[model samples]
Target: MLRFFTRSVLSLIVASASTCPARSSSASRPAFIAAFALSPPSAPSTSCQATMTASVAAESTDLPRWDLSRFGFSSPFSDEIDLHLEETAKLAEAFKAKYEGKLGELSLLSAIQDYEEISKRKTLVSSYLHLSYDVSLDDDTLKKRKGALSQRQSEIYGDNLEWFSLDVAELDDAVLASQYENDPSLTKFKSFIDELRRQKPHNLSKDVERALTVRSPYVGNRPLVSFFDKELSLMRFKLDEDGKEVNMEVLLSRMQSSNDAAFRAKCLQVLNEGLAGSVSRTAALSLSSVAGGWLVENKERKYINLRSRRNLDNNCPDEVVDSLLVGVRSAGIPLCKRFYTLKKGILQKTQGLDKFRWSDRNAPIDIGGVSNEKISWEAAVAMVKKGYNQFSPKMSEMFVSMVEEKRIDVPAANGKKGGAYCAGVIPGVGPFQLLNFDGTKQDVATLAHESGHGVHDILAYEQGYLQYHPPLTLAETASIFGEMIVFRDLLAQSSSKEEELTLLMSKIDDVVNSVVRQCSFDRFEELVHTAREKGELSADELDEYWMSALREYYGKEGDAGGDSPFDSYENTSHLWSYVPHFHHVPFYVYSYAFADLVVGTLYNNFLTNKEGFEGRLLALLSAGGTKDFANALGPFGLDPTSSTFWTEALTAHLGELVNEAEKIAKELGYVE
Candidate 1:
């Protein structure tokens, strides 16, 4: 069986399809709650404070939201977690003793079964530790334990299973095919085996692999990445809020819909200054180290190009990703330009602004009919449930059950991580969602988006450890689709044209974010990673790379030359310092564009055939990592490899939204 080991963390609220605007490169992207900072929460509405408090009280009473005990653990310090770790360690030793240096001689069934058993146990323990740490990064004990356990687990895998894939890859194709035909048990592992074989050319000698693995903890880029996250998390930025000195998080939340452009601009200035002054040097060094490691590996591996390494992991063909990039850039950038132009016009008419700042990218257009009031927790849940239930009752039930079981941590508190992500622990234990929910429409969409990931996790649990998680290319299917479903439903219920326009513009922003902005980020990554081969990049060089990408995508404001409304790129240069993805997972940002286009295409099909779409969509999610990207989308008649797929999806879906919003603007007299 393909063991499903699922980890789902998506950040919502980058009006462009990202968790955060900073997510231009994988190094800068957050791992789980990628978008936690993209959209700030609404100020608690004075009118609904009582109701909000009551709802929080009612929800808080049901503590211990996640059922970690199902995995034979409760907390990070629980005896069960330690006992499980000990058991896993022993199993690792026993497995190593049995299989080391004898892998080619063992029957395929025996090899797979042994591997599966060991992986399942290790996943259970490690997954629990990860969940505990994500929810409470401030807990030093838990943080240390998570790190120690992760290192130990890595060691165990290295020591015991270092040769498994290389050996499997070395097997004769005919012999492997014969084994598969003779042993029915191997059928489920076909995808896993095929993916392993893809790495055959790059596989190192067992000794070298083991050596690298053993020294990995100290020599790898992880330490640098960890330092950046720790340093950024610890550095406090003081913002004057209502004459009170508060942390950056407070200002970020207040800045979202501050109604005061000056205040928002100041908050943006403070954020940039703080990150630039204290964090940029560390971030620049980390990126250099990470990019340097990639260059070294690329040379050693002798892969086709800079991205072949990540392409192998994603099981994506080079042509497909190339097509995706070209298609998105050609189709998405112009549409992005059009949307921003419309936005500038509307904001100018509504807010009386001479020109907009980068901070005003997500500024709300105050329409007479739209409500900017804070949504209560209860109402947010109801809205999400209603929206989801419109598509699938099963999905709606999943959201409700998460709430009832307390599987969601929904408040922003000191020491709690920013952003939101669905961490799907091992099978038999449902997924847990972490959110800094601040009761905004974006927050509700985030609720739906992360819930979509939880649903995908729940469905994919049957695939077991190796097959449970989809590649990054297909990873955002359910989550982005969830956002679309909710957004459409919300638009359907809008009472006026202005309200509808607000929702439409937001969704369009998300699509552009996901597609155009992310592709631009990918372009930056390609440049920087290529540049890093020459030497380490200084902070200024990194800023130059960022500004170059912005100009290409957003364009310059005046002279009628480019897409942007201003030339304020200098202030946002340090923005790259905070994205977690770029540091940890290179070449991963394109997956957002890949997912957005795929989901947009799939969603259009669903609209055409609503009666039969649910089953097919569910089946796609359930396949998990067992199928490659093309096969997963085959049912929807979407070919990601084709340029048409990307261009048509962008024009038909995102372009339509932009066109409709323009029409609405003209109708409302905001534009002619």
Candidate 2:
């Protein structure tokens, strides 16, 4: 469930459809933080300071910091950055002058090649600045420097390059077809051209487009989003157990891992209260502005629905996304309830809890022969490498190269961003991973997940910058697949039934979080955006939307005099205020469910037919954005457009896992 920021400068320039009408100054990376709502594995009790210190010091000698020098910059203040910026701007101006009004007359292939080169240089600088900024959010100097460069980029692109796509979109269909027929080299950009053509109906006039792009840095919701990140990162919550205040990441980990039900509940209360007053109000404003701006653009473009814009960008059809959502609600809701019901029973028998509150949903169980110890940084890396090696040696080598090349930042520190993400900057630079490696089992899985993204990036480097990033629907395929292989490898190595049961339950927790919990998140977003059309919503109103979604998915407590596993929603109402994806990308959460189910089917195929499966998966990853999700799945003999594809995948994967866990729980006398 870690975030993957795969968009580059070229993506922003080439693609007209965006979550916001005006593109942000730093839109090079999709401002997605996907792990905020995901469930983490359980661990033994430790003080927040002790945990942070241990995480950093445990492998201080071994944990690798990103070698920014590889990006041709010694530091953020390096003179090379400014030199590169000037060169890129000049190149962009020259490109604009050469092909501003001559796209139809010139060789389409040559124009695109020049565009790609400019995009590559622009991405290199922007990526370094943004990546450097993420690790140290509190550094005002770095922040200001990045902002200035981004503004220059915005102006450079707005004035010099924004017309390229608009002009290309206006090209006659016959001209493009003729170009392709005349020179097969033009075929490499077929997908990229098709995307521009698809946005033709929504394209605004040249002056309007230029104005929006230039004013976006000041007028867009990006400033508000930045405020949200800085404000939340500065806030701290105090643990009731030892009166120690911790940041959001540590506090969330405690809420997920603490064996003590009361402690976990207190942590939730502290978290809720910390985010209550001004924080929630500001977040409400940010969310409303982001959604409001998106809707305005949607209306102007005449998109069909609230999610249509994002679906188009993802290269997924509206009907396919609809099927995925309906399928999850119909089949996934029942499966989620069943799993939680089993969880409630096991907790009742093991911990003697009379009532299962919302906070106890992710509480770790005390199954014997299972370790609650923290994993060391080195051990975690070795474990992930081994897991990848078990699946494919080439993939394992990619993972190792990432570590040896110092392409990963592997510790949690104050002012560092919460959650984890893999930034596929551009080709020839490989991928850089940002992780808050706290040494939990979930942290290990996260390492494996991001490494999967890195491997995918390495394989897809051949696609170059223009079509290098896959749509969101297929982006999570490799990460989730990477996690699954690691889980399977560990499960096979379990020494006893107790260990097996523990692993099964943890895996189920992850799957539910990815598929069911993410669907619920998407529902919450749907309600908020749909309601925001009537004016701004209050923080209290936002809370109601949050609770409504939770109730529908988890079921209300004692509804209709029927027994329900979940307790009343108490401190969970304002939880929506903290999820970054809601504010950053509208309707982006469902992609997690889409990817999980897709990978589930593919993994099943891998288990059943080990022959040539590895090559097929690699090919899919290498295809990048050249193919749509449906066509991408064609090689595997799967069709995502089918009505029952989602349901069948859910049943075959999550349902089967739940059934196995329930049987094991019964045999162990934890459930009747």
Candidate 3:
């Protein structure tokens, strides 16, 4: 299995939650670097280099060089990496022997300290392996090393530390409190311990937990997810651009941006055919295993439903998530339908399409002089920096450092992974960002978004190795905020009403994708998991579930005021197969919706009170997992659990954007 390790034991415990520094007269970089270093401060990185030709650059007009040696290794095959792995294994054995069967007996402070120490060690090694593999997915050596490290970590954990959670769960509350009173050091971990104890009701016996861990590679959804990624890496869609063969990422981007309706349609057709026909059965089996495995485990663990485990993991209540779902279904779907109907009118005038197909959902409206031209790498960075600088100079500085220090790998290459992500291993080392930059406006937003994550990782490092990563519920806050800041900047600076309309429409489209589409994905997962409890679902059945979600969120065809009604999801029935999140992190899609809604609320507050807003926002980013989702947002006067929160956010933010875009369309004579 591909090792997804970061932040040590917490990565496994939290399942994915996971971050570094610099020097200069500004005092910011130096302070961060000093805090990040395990030893003495070192010279700034000088070795990270990119080998991309200027013309062949994918999405990025300018490719970035990433300095990996800053992490203390030159390459995956470095002697230091080998020695570190060996040392990690040795330390794990010793630590296991010392603490195995003694977790309950040890003092709370001692156990916490030991756990933190061991976690730090494990995190550094595992993070290096993962970061290395992420950039070079096609490298067999890195792949093998990553797998070995992952398996070894899992083995050691299953054999030794599997009892840790059970022991923590079973510890008497009074005793734990007494320990905290006796040792002030234990107070720091109060939140962490509280969260562990919350799992008591769902935790299995130590033996059962150990068995699960030991059998993880063969029995869980992760391996199946790995298989899916590998297969997707090989699947290609032939494009009309010079008859070029491209991967799913390229195809999807082209479908969304291509001005030629026929090309877009062909791309969608190829995409649908490629996914539904070639790999649907394999995907179906993978989904079955994932849903079925969760069903079986959920039953044994006594979860309320398939989503219960995820909600618990997110530290959110069932009612809170359900309320969001209900609110989105009731309010968001209609708003989305309204926007798409407006889009249909615009497209009809522009592209002469009487009845839009599913492929037309993402069709861009051509507004002359608005300039959909590709943004250069420097231009994108400048735009992102300007946005961050307006909000927080610290954020802007960090973004610049990432670019100057070559901590980012930009540009899309064949076999390189799609999408964007930021990973930070330890405090002193900072964060690493990966992007397949194809120079679209969307790509620029992705840069801002991932940079936001990097900034969050850096600030949160103050929380230490054990608690520096936020849950998924809060993980997206910084990234989405970064995107919004840049987007709002663009909207404010538009040269004309038409340009403003284009920007407004573009932002609205993104909002729809993030909010409504994600809810639809959540619905699909709900349906699949619910159905899987009865039995395995066929490809056809999964397709129905996928289409059902589409109609629910996007409305039935012809509702968008087309000439005739049609099945909008007919061609994209197999899209669910490509969503790796379904396999890697079940029920994780809703977090995007949660973050978008919450960000809308917070962004409104920032706009209302520009004074000291950055400082307040930084406090939230620095919190890491120290606070739950609600408490983290409490400082901003936002409560996600409130019944009215979702609807209010949808109306005030996304709905308002749609309304503004429609008003603009009318002004432009595209609609009356």
For 445-519, candidate 3 gives per-residue lDDT tens digits of 767776877888789888876667676677778877887899999888988888898888777776776678778
lDDT (CA) per prediction: 0.67, 0.71, 0.67
Structural similarity to truth (TM-score) of each candidate? 0.90, 0.91, 0.89
lDDT of 1 by residue, 1-672 (tens): 112122112321234211211111111111111111111111100000000110111112322335556566656777776677678778878877887666555678677677777776776665566556545657887767666765676577667766676677788888887787778887887777776787778866888877665555556676677667667556566665565454444555666656677777887788788878558999899889989988887777678887877777778888888988888778888888888889888988888866677777777778875777888778988998999999999889987988888787777555554455565555667576666566677667777777777788788878875567677777677778788888999889888999988888777766776678667767888889999988999988998898788778888755445547653553577777765556756676777777778888888888787777899999999998788888988887777777588889889889889999999999999987
Task: Provide the lDDT at 345 for model 3.
Answer: 82
Candidates arranged by TM-score, highest first? 2, 1, 3
Instruction: State the displacement of the C-alpha of residue 327, model 1, in Å, after optimal TM-score superposition.
Output: 1.5
The regions of model 1 sitting more than 4 angstroms off are 1-13, 16-67, 101-105, 241-248, 559-563
Give all candidate RMSDs, comma-separated. Answer: 6.0, 6.3, 7.7
Error of 1 at 671 (Å): 0.7
Q: Could you say which candidate leads in TM-score? A: 2
